[model samples]
Target: MTTDPPPEPNREPTPGRLHRARTAFRRWRRTRPFWAAVWTGLGGFVIFFLPMAPLGKILQVGLGGIAGMAGGVLLMAMALLILLLPGQRHTAGVIAVIAGVASFPLSNLGGLFVGMVLSVLGGSMAFAWLPEKPARRRRPRRTTPSAETPVSLGSGSA
Candidate 1:
C-alpha cells in the first residue's frame, strides 16, 4: 500500500477572538475622536475630584463646591456626547470649551489649570478630527511595442 504524506499545517495562523476584538476596536477608534474623548474624560475627572479632595482647602477658588461639580459634570457629559455622536463634534467641542472656561470661575482654577488645558485640547482635537478618505484602486498600465525596436527571427543574419 502506498503511504501518503500527512497534510501540512497551515503556514498562516488564523487570528483568534482577541485579535479580532482588538482589530474591531482599532477600526472604531479610528472612525471617532478617541483621544479627544479620553482627554476630556480625564479633565472632567480632575475637575470633579479635586474640589472634593483635602487639597480643596488650598485650591478652592470657585463660587462653591456645587458649581465646580456642575461644571465638571457638564464637561464629562460633553466628552461622552462627542464619542457617541461624532457628527455633532463641533457642537460638543464648543460646549466643552465653554464648560472648561467656566470651570475656572466655577471650579478650583479649572482644577489648577490642568483640567482646563486638557479640556480645551480635547475639544479642539475633536473639532478638528476628520474622516479618512477611502483609497482608490489604480489601473494597471499597458505597454505597447515600440516601432523603434527591430523584431528578431530564428534565422541567423549573414
Candidate 2:
C-alpha cells in the first residue's frame, strides 16, 4: 500500500481584499460625519444643477442663476470642510446652513425646497456629531455570596 502524506496544519482563512477594504471603510466612517457630508454634497449638487437645467425656466425668479451658483458652491465646500476637519464641523455646519437658506431665494426655490431641506438637515447632523469614547472592560461579578452578607437558612424558620 502507498503511504499517505502528512495532513496539513489547520489555518484560518484570510479575509479577501474587498472584505478588508469594506471593513476599513466602515471604521473610517464611524469616526467621521459621513452621512452629513453626503447630504450636504447632494444638496449642493441639486442647487447647482437646477439653474442650468431646462426645468429651471419654470422656477426662475430674481437674480437666481449667478447667486444660486455661488451659494451652491459654498455649501459644497462646507461639506468637504466638515469631512476633512471634524473638529471644525460646527463652523462648517453653520456655513452650510446659511448657504442652504440663501439658496432658496437664489436657486430655483432652493432646488424646489428639496436641496434646502437636505442641506439644513446635513448641517444639523454635522453640528451634532460627536466622537465615540472607547469602551471600558468591566470586571466579572462574583457569583458566590460574600462573608459580609449572611445567608438565609430555610426562610429563617423551620
lDDT of 1 by residue, 1-158 (tens): 99999999879888999999999999999889989988888888889888885656535554657777787898899899989899999999988888888888777789999998989888888889897878889989898779998877778977
Question: Model 1 misses residue 148 by how many Å?
Answer: 7.4
C-alpha lDDT (0 to 100) for residue 1 of candidate 2: 94
Worst 10 residues of 1 by lDDT: 53-62
* Number of the top TM-score candidate: 2
Candidate 1 wrongly placed segments (more than 4 Å):
1-12, 53-62, 139-158
Worst 10 residues of 2 by lDDT: 53-62
Best by lDDT: 2
Give the per-residue Cα lDDT of candidate 2 at 106: 74
TM-score of each: 0.75, 0.76
